[model samples]
Target: MNAQIAPPPAAAGWQAVIGLEIHAQLSTASKLFSGAPTAYGAEPNTQASLVDIALPGTLPVPNRAAIRKAIQFGLAIGAPIAPHSVFARKNYFYPDLPKGYQISQYELPVVGPGKLKVRVDDGRTIEVEIQRAHLEEDAGKSVHDAFHAETGIDLNRAGTPLLEIVSAPVMHSAAEAVAYMRTVHTLVRWLGICDGNMQEGSFRCDCNVSVRRSGTEQLGTRTEIKNVNSFRFVEKAIEYEIERQIRALENGEAIVQETRLYDPTRHQTRSMRSKESADDYRYFPDPDLPPLAIGAAEIERERSALPELPQARRERYIAVLGLPEADADQLCSDRATADYFEAVLAGVPGQAKLCANWVLGEVAAALNENAVEIAAAPVDAAALAQLLSRLREGVISGKIAKDVFAAMWAGEGSADVIIEARGLKQISDTGALATAIDAVLAEYAGQVADYRKGNDKLLQFFVGQVMKRTRGQANPQQLNELLKQKLAG
Candidate 1:
């Protein structure tokens, strides 16, 4: 499943090729082929059914919901869905595998070749091709520290449905691979197929890395970095592996094809075992389940039910709403954030940039400061929209609005209620501004004389004094105009 696309320029006469295999655990109530619960944090082996444990004479019936989710993912990426796909048994020996073989799709997969456009750190978009996305069952977990010198097996996760998404080896650096991984993670969550929780093992990535000389069309031997959970670790692991391979090659040593593990504590990768090829797995068609047949009607139904995807929403935010690409990308990073932005826009129509700034700036800072998500913020969308509406209406200055926002976040009250109680209304009246200007002129008579004598910068000093007098509620535009007029006289 290794292929190449046009990559970025080589680094120091060497080029690195990277691809990712993302395993997304499907969000279903039950296991793929059994009625066992798929909830996390259950007692050890508490949820494993007879079918999940592979009891003799227990036949598996494929869950229709899992199949439907796989189809949904295929349609989301504009990939063709196979009318007939088969499940095959991949033979392997592991302590966590209840059955001797894992049922997976090999020759005939549920999803065909697809592509995704990912934006890197430098704001350049790279189109990465996907080899395939197949359906499979997950193996149980092995707990090594649970017992004294004895490994414990947890079969609760066995028989869980997973969609393994394989990508072409077209990426040239760690940045590109991380960008592609993030794009897929956002997509599955947006499509409602997977929760995209890397910490909970709901979504994970396996990185395949190789390095070759600058001008050679021939590929180099590759290694697999197995089960990197977080985005930061993925980038670091690939970087270390690329350096390791290149250093080995330069020192007159051939790179070995093997699997490795990333140690976050040591920030290095160590050899896990020798890599296994497809032939080693001894794949064969599963006799327990028939060929999964998906009709055209099913495909159409899933396609019609899809919500407005992230890319489309991003484009609309940019072209129609006149937002910058960076703002749109940040807002559309997740579904809940985008929805909250839209809700604010709904309250105040025609203020796209303002809404984006508040969402990405102040609101974002508060969320990070309190370590809470947008959904759980103390100030919800409607309240924020109301606050923004007042600012739009010239009811309060930008500085005053921030103070109001702080109060609102503290569970005080609405913007209007707080503003009224504190008398923080903007001072835009000409008479009130003129009185403040006159008082400041009389107080700083020497500075006023210097200002008329061509010290134009003194104007700002007077403006600051006026703002202080008004308790930072002075309308900036009005204050400056009236101050300049009186100073000329």
Candidate 2:
């Protein structure tokens, strides 16, 4: 929910508390409790099955694949897995909900409490406590169209699997909350549980915000902002709400407990409805489906088959590879980017920093320019490593290597072939570089004299002249040496 509110108090009396509820649409072939297809963009009710429509005598059967994915997510966050957990029916009325109740996990959830590290702006890590992650079935869509006098109901999304992750009210600012959301987003995608596509409504965030005086530990009245999809909106909505609460508290007004909708256009929030408590939903154990159970052997199997997680990958990039914190963080932000970086390292071992620079610098620019994902890039990691190797071997200067990269991007051959065809090889020959340096020194006698008279900054001037004379083909290190030798004379 994007909303506009008053600015936060500048004085020392106010502090904000924030928590998040994230729903990740599991990437399963069918719905959580039904055999209906979970594919998007299908016609309205085509994907709904008899079970999805809640026809008489149509009982739900649990999908084992979806449960295994939930287990994978719990294990990734180091959360305890319950051997047995039950599902409940949450009763609510909506036109799109044919069953008039949602089957979900309540008192007993599959995943227990967990913790994850979120990065702040100052390069420090803080732990966000996760309350629980529970499995639930999604409600269908109610589409309101301007062309139609009445609303439309779509049951395709109904019965789809979702993992609702709740977090403790531990964040103190908008930055921390946004960072936590991003960290969770990266994690779910990395674990292959969810696609993490906010635009398609695959992943969404609902934030709980409240404000209190700085010294008090007692909590304040909180409001729930429902389903703001983007990360920027999450930050903006919380910021506006915090300010609104602080201003209200300062004016001796009480905060109302309600559900609000964010207006991105107006930059403000409006009351959607009175917030519902747990009692309001009347959650009860569902009698139709039996309690789901997991064995130790299954948990062990999932653990052993786990892929390398984001935090461990970040640490390895830092401690073992000797990369800086920022570099490590950027490289490990996504699974595909990290895999690409590691592939480059495999091609050119022992050049970790160089590999990081190229990947984060030029390669990133190229990807952004072409509007292509790293996995779909025209240049692969081995090809990039080959180009960097030519630069490392003194076959081309860094300046010339860039042109060769452009040629490769244009679908030219390997770096060596491009270099040979374009006559772009570096001039590392001592005799040739020496003659060029001497000629430049003879022409720029005034500047050469200035350099001998202790104007050390003029060294760059002499190097520039030699580079110009050699048409930018001279090896920079060799030119620097030859310039010093001739100038000393």
Candidate 3:
């Protein structure tokens, strides 16, 4: 019980206080402040509404679907749904914002205070506290042509609803931040509130990276890494930022407060601009829209329908299914794969462990290498369950089961149909097995003599001969037992 865990990276004589601001675009049919379509990759400005394009007389309205989604996320994370949250004007003149200032939640957010349990690189769990998750409308894009002169503005993504999830400075290493991001990504996607596609710009992260001493409590100056497009890059960016900061501090140089970009090929973070403080935004209340006021009853309703989260489900799988902790954790890593695992294992008699093996070993491996989900897998759940039942019943050898699995993946028929069509039934009949063994013994009289002379290795030879004689149809246990009895006699 007193096992030593791997300690966090070198103390640097300074403490790193890490925090995260995650922007997850809510899944909805229309834009957040307009009736225009929120679809991606439209003809430039084609989906723009009067409000999105910010016509002189256009009035902004909140999207009801996006509001409900924000509530669902807060409830899922056990965060507070603020009864009173305001819309603020964050003033920054950029071409993407048709409105002079973008409307966002600043003074009071829709949700506040949640926590994420991240698995560190050393297999230890660290709780990354979340300060708040707020709702805000996204701005449009400014497209700069590499070869052309004019800077074009696309209002297609304008007024899109984005849930800004902010984390506290609790993460100590790049690995922990990456794990926390994955947990957040899965939670939003599983709840059907966000698409969680970083490449599609639906879910993105800005990590506040800093470094500190191993035992000190005081904080070090942190730099914010911006627009990390993928999970691998997130970790990479944090690592580079950490080393850069530590080097900067050690070399007697001031760590400038700044925003930075991660170069994927170069694997380093470059300074984007000198960081701007909150005061620099010139924050003011948005006069266009009123505050968000969702009641406790509405929050309670969303919480009631919230499905069991990933961590809770993982614990349940171990306790209910009698699986080892590692196996259960692996099985429940994703909601889709976990659901498929349950479908095949539930109600199957005396097969929980075996079913897990097939799932983790075969199904999961296939999915990972091919980069597909169980839902979209060529093999269906029922078909896989039936195949497992066949395996349990001794209708085919496990080797033959592999063949059956491959056949199904290649668009063959169901388990029974495949077995029948391919003549893959297991030979468990005692009489037929005995006949096959007798033939192997007679043909292999020399090997039989060796096995009888206490050359136990020859028994494997006899089993091989029996299988060859039966064309690999013998049930292994029955074959071994029958072979042993006749050989001993």
Candidate 4:
């Protein structure tokens, strides 16, 4: 189901203010500040390095690849890339954080203010403001159920590089928040900076939600829903949080400013801990790592290397390709799908609409049924293009093409081979169509007589008979014309 926001029943006189803190793990070979490998599903602490574990006499050095990725993201969003940014130690204590303080950007972020345009489920576009995006190292996992009454710590992710994207509290509904998140998800993947895999913990969201009386300038006390991974869960968590805050205010109870976790099984947000202010974290510049610096040339280099972004591709698909808005949107949702679409178009030029129909219709259904991505589809784009070319040139009817496509997906030979082997070519020959039409008219003589006597509806029956006799391989336009001429006499 598509993620959508439905207003709560008690939300008549109240409004929701939502902002999201998205953590996207950077795609790199090693950790942010050490030489430790950052691969997932390793044997726990085997991947943790001495620097990641905060061993004595160890110092941290920032990964250049991670920094470049952060800059690439900044440029992609049209944000100002800070020439100089400082890393501060965020003082916090957790079981997964081996270091007492997490090294992160506080006052000076790598990326400044930006905005992203999001399309909601209702087809309306809304622009969400980005406050800042800073670089940070991820903490490890605290496994609770791995043991009977004890916990296990996995340090494989402790030092994984992360880009924490913070957005302004400009969203008013769960739907908008989700739309904004999905847009970022697509952008990061398109930029080749982040994998955007939510299940693997490469991408996650912390939703800051609050409710206030409508038409008020003052914002309400907000609670943070931390680390909701999936889009549907994000929407559900925000909806529940919004309704919870509104009910509390209506009942004369003040909403608490705290951090909460979404329990998917229960569909509720429960308090985890009291939210800490910046003062509580005691942010200060790290002494070990010097202030990072970026040059203008580096930013421009990243900018020039970026592929066409999703929004631009979507617009081009609509304006240049003449595709419908919805079709273009779906096509550009993923870079792979969009690339495949263009490949098909390259094979069969001037047939953008037809190419889109086959890709979005037959190709999509085949991928879904076989549980594979477009990259791993049984039928390649060139093969599908070949099939479409045959259909375009009247070698086969649309229905017959579907049959050939199914056969191709099942490891059958090329479309030409299948069509030839099965005698599936459309009967567009004037001689053959006329002979078939005469046979149908002779067999249904009463209907043909009634049709000439002004019962025009019988023409369809005659056409159906001709199609049935031809095994649905008749060219529709040719059959209609020849059948009409035969009935006239």
Error of 3 at 464 (Å): 1.8
- Write model 1 residue lDDT over 8-114, tens digit each, in one string: 66777999999899999999999999999999999999999998888899988899999999998898888999999999999998889978999999999999999
| lDDT by residue (tens digit), candidate 3, 124-191 | 87777888888787888887874388888888998989999999988777777888898888889878
RMSD from true fold, candidate 3: 2.1
Per-residue lDDT value at 191 in model 4: 84
Q: After superposition, how far is residue 330 of candidate 2 from its true place, in Å?
A: 0.8
Q: lDDT per model, in order?
A: 0.92, 0.89, 0.84, 0.91
Error of 3 at 377 (Å): 1.9
Please provide, for model 2 over 1-489, each residue's C-alpha lDDT reduced to its tens digit, 9 standing for 90 to 100: 112232333336788999999999999999999888999889889999998989999999988888998999899889998999999999988989989999999999999999998777655578889999999999889999744788888899999999999999988888889989999999999998999999988999899999888878999999999999989888889889999888889889999999888878766777788765533888889999888899999999999999999999999998999999889999999999999999988988899998999899988999999998999888899999999988889989989988888888788988888999988888999999998988888898999889899999999988888888888999999888877888888
Residue 284: error of model 3 in Å? 2.6
Pairs that clash in candidate 1: none
TM-score of each: 0.94, 0.92, 0.95, 0.94
Poorest 10 consecutive residues of model 3 by lDDT?
1-10
- Candidate 4's displacement at residue 231, Å, is 1.2
